[model samples]
Target: MSNLIPTGRTDIEWRNESTQKPPKAAVYPAEANADKILKAAYEHTATVWTGDFHNAKQVLAAMKKRVKRPSEKKRAGGGDAVAERSRNIQTAFHAHRMKQAQQSRILNMLAVEIGAGFTLDIPRAPDVKAALADVYGKPNDAPFLLPLNQLLGFIGAHEWHKKGVEIPALGGRIHVPFGVFSPLRGEYLDLIAAALAGSKFQTAFDIGTGSGIIAALLAKHGVPKITATDTNPRAVACACANFCRLDLDNIVIEKTDLFPAGCADLIVCNPPWLPAKPSSAVEAALYDPESRMLEGFLNGAAAHLNDGGEVWLVMSDLAEHLHLREQDFLPQCFQTASLEIAEVLQTRPKHAKAADENDPLAFARGREVTSLYRLKKAV
Candidate 1:
């Protein structure tokens, strides 16, 4: 039997000690299986073993393509194409959920096996046990089971950590820990760097500092002191780890909802680009339902800025192009917050998704642009 218990704010713990074990981890059942689950998993995780972080993403994309289409052709004699597509989508969703659940159970079982090795003085499972410890922060003996997908994700992130991403603008390679947000977009950083260069302030505040990249960039560019804040525990850990790695511990990393009560000469925020509900916790990068982060930054920025101070807001107009948000509402927001726009620096996205013509939102993405706006609190 499995016992459900609350562990952390974001995760639940499942303790299963019954003789009847949980389901086996789902894998491609056979080499000849049409779904090719094993092949996909191997390819997606190969970079993890090799320390090529970027390539792992490419492999995952390829795997997505394999399971994309429905088995029945559109021309098959089975109802309208739209209905068939919907049915196929529902089927796919169920299968994906089941696979994820089974995989989680399997990994839980593996964790138990690793724990037993340590408990019974078994000698052969050191590597697997050690890897699990490295990622989970505990030996296999712990009565908690992590989701298999999450375990795989951590393993992949560890590989990326080993490789490390370089930020030329900051003149440093930032070591992002497993499960931290990596700075994949350079154009945004360029805009931020430019904004920092143009600003006259010496002190700055970074809101929602995921990996503290922006704060680090500001510090690297000669900002004397910076207060970087994040609400997520993982992000806070990530920021601290990155700051220590870059030797920027002088830039204080704090766990706060947004601002930590003080005024700075400059305040900077890079909120999520779209105002949509995130599909998963990891998708926070692309979604900010109701524009919570953006609105909070704007509303509270004035109070946290010194008189004549500036707030630099970096965001993309893709949401507007998608008809998900009003394009003209940003200026209105500033007006409501009693702030005035000082200057706007814009840049085009360089990611392949922006240029891929086959993308569902290609038409909108091609015309999309990211901007860095410097706003000042009214006198």
Candidate 2:
């Protein structure tokens, strides 16, 4: 058992004996312990959790089953009480985090089995050791170990990279690279296309441009100039790659948290629809938790809009229908931000999850609604 403590924040560098490739490893947090590391490895491997990788994944998914279990049991039946339900949800969230943290710790404690080749003893190790090596910039013979949680994260990210979703709305489909968000919802894309049909803006800014889909759409619609900005390095890389592929290299992709230091005739944002704590880094698309992105866009939008410029706010009232958020509070947020609603375009979600009767929030889905609001900064 070799314990290598990182000196500081600097990455750990290693050389592969066979492939002569160099790779850098991330430093683990100081407080990680052996038990936490072991738990993470067990979670990743199907043997301890089960023997099948898919089964292990299903077990992990079971953690979220309660989040949508309310609709299955009739209102007056032997279902959990409201208070119990809330507590269960809270527990689910905490357990999810605990599992993730343990996984990260395990990856940090991982030790490499070095010989003529390399292998990892971590539980349920991914079959894509070659792919992982490529990403880590190492050869198959490089002897290195990463935290169990981090290794799982890398493998999950690799899968997502391999099976990229294509957006039909954007003529040139955007690919989701590792650690970048994939556009999983299609209803919102339809809403955006319809909303942009009658609008005329030569220059536009796409705030929080995850995969740069909006920017690509603007460019496709004959908009000569579009600026796409995101704070995440993964998002920036994904967006740039999509733009380059579409030959919209003119669409500048910036690494800004929000708006750039200039104004635009049109600014558009599709902030996460729900305001709740995210279960993981990947859940940013589903939950903003703090409404930080939504608020930031609204508060800074007025300053970035040109004369008669419009800020397109695409969102859903699903949270409101589920009682998680107040429907009327959205307009109030606009008012507080000093903006007025110019127009509202509504659409229904096409995802099967929306109409899933078994979902805990299905009551809302039965009558759920989503909309796109065009707002203008008050003069």
Candidate 3:
């Protein structure tokens, strides 16, 4: 793989294992005594929270009082491995608390119970009908869950006078329906915004336009015409709703795998960065194992792009640190896709992973760089 491409020239770099000190905080995975954890959790009361979602609400409520707000705590001064073990326990406890919180939330939102099969007890509403139809496709009034989180978001958006959550980068909030991925929370949105700010676009297409954030930004940037697409039906509906909420109906959204139709002067894509299978639907926006979506975009870009037009592919090398991707994998992608790296616009991430020293992958995460690859069809 090293012979396939030289990495010395690129803006990205692999982990320097030698320079990194053995991480100060050590965690004993097995040393975590379940009995001790459970006793602490129940406050010596009955073990209402042992290890399942059945008592999730109770466990999470108890955890909230104990877990510190994900902090390092004034450096915690010096401590031996035991002290480090304590910190690790704290971190793990924090993670457990969070998992419980999520489980509780999901359990509470299971409006429709599943017993025998796919039966759902859906709440009837005007928008609910559309949401149900959007997810179920020609309702049988059968028992099926319609990605209620997004439906709830849609419902919430309608009830609230505001359009959506505010994005300082987009200069406003984008109403992200329950499932649609929010771009404002991460650096990619800001990086994409910065890259597009100095460039002029006559026509553009936003691939995988979750929540239509990029498409909306393009329209706001004064691009005359724009087209956006997503394979997820919920995302298609969500993006459309957000476009309407932002009053940018000019951006046409379609349900497609990667590309829509003819070429445009500029194309933008923000693929799932991780090369791992997502655990659930909402996680799809973040995890794309095997780089399926990323590869698809690169492989198909040459066909959809107009001559001299560039496809701005947003990427990050953090996956490299997590041992998820090979260092040369990205360059090999450009070569395989018959695309040339015209320019690499990169920024060291300000995200939590970069600042976290206690993280197991801190060495890699600390040096992670997020970049927008300005790629073009090879002539």
**Predicted model with the maximum TM-score:** 1
TM-score of each: 0.71, 0.69, 0.64
Per-residue lDDT over 38-72 for candidate 2, one digit per residue giving the tens place of the 0 to 100 score: 44344432112213344434443443342323553
* Candidate 3 overall lDDT versus native: 0.61
lDDT of 3 by residue, 1-379 (tens): 0011111222211111011111111111222233343443233111112122323334334444444344534332233432453444435433443554443333222122211232333233233544333333464432322222334444454444234677777787776644566664557777777777778778898999988888988888788899998988778888887888778867999899889889898989989988765545667888897899999998988888888889999888877755668889999999999999888888887767577666534545666788989898877
Q: How much does candidate 2 score in TM-score?
A: 0.69
Best-to-worst ranking by lDDT: 1, 2, 3
Q: lDDT (0-100) at residue 266 of candidate 1?
A: 89
Lowest summed lDDT window (length 10), candidate 2 = 15-24
Query: Model 2 off-target regions past 4 Å?
Result: 1-160
Deviation in angstroms for 151 in model 2? Answer: 5.7
What's model 1's TM-score? 0.71
Top-scoring candidate (lDDT): 1
Error of 1 at 314 (Å): 0.5
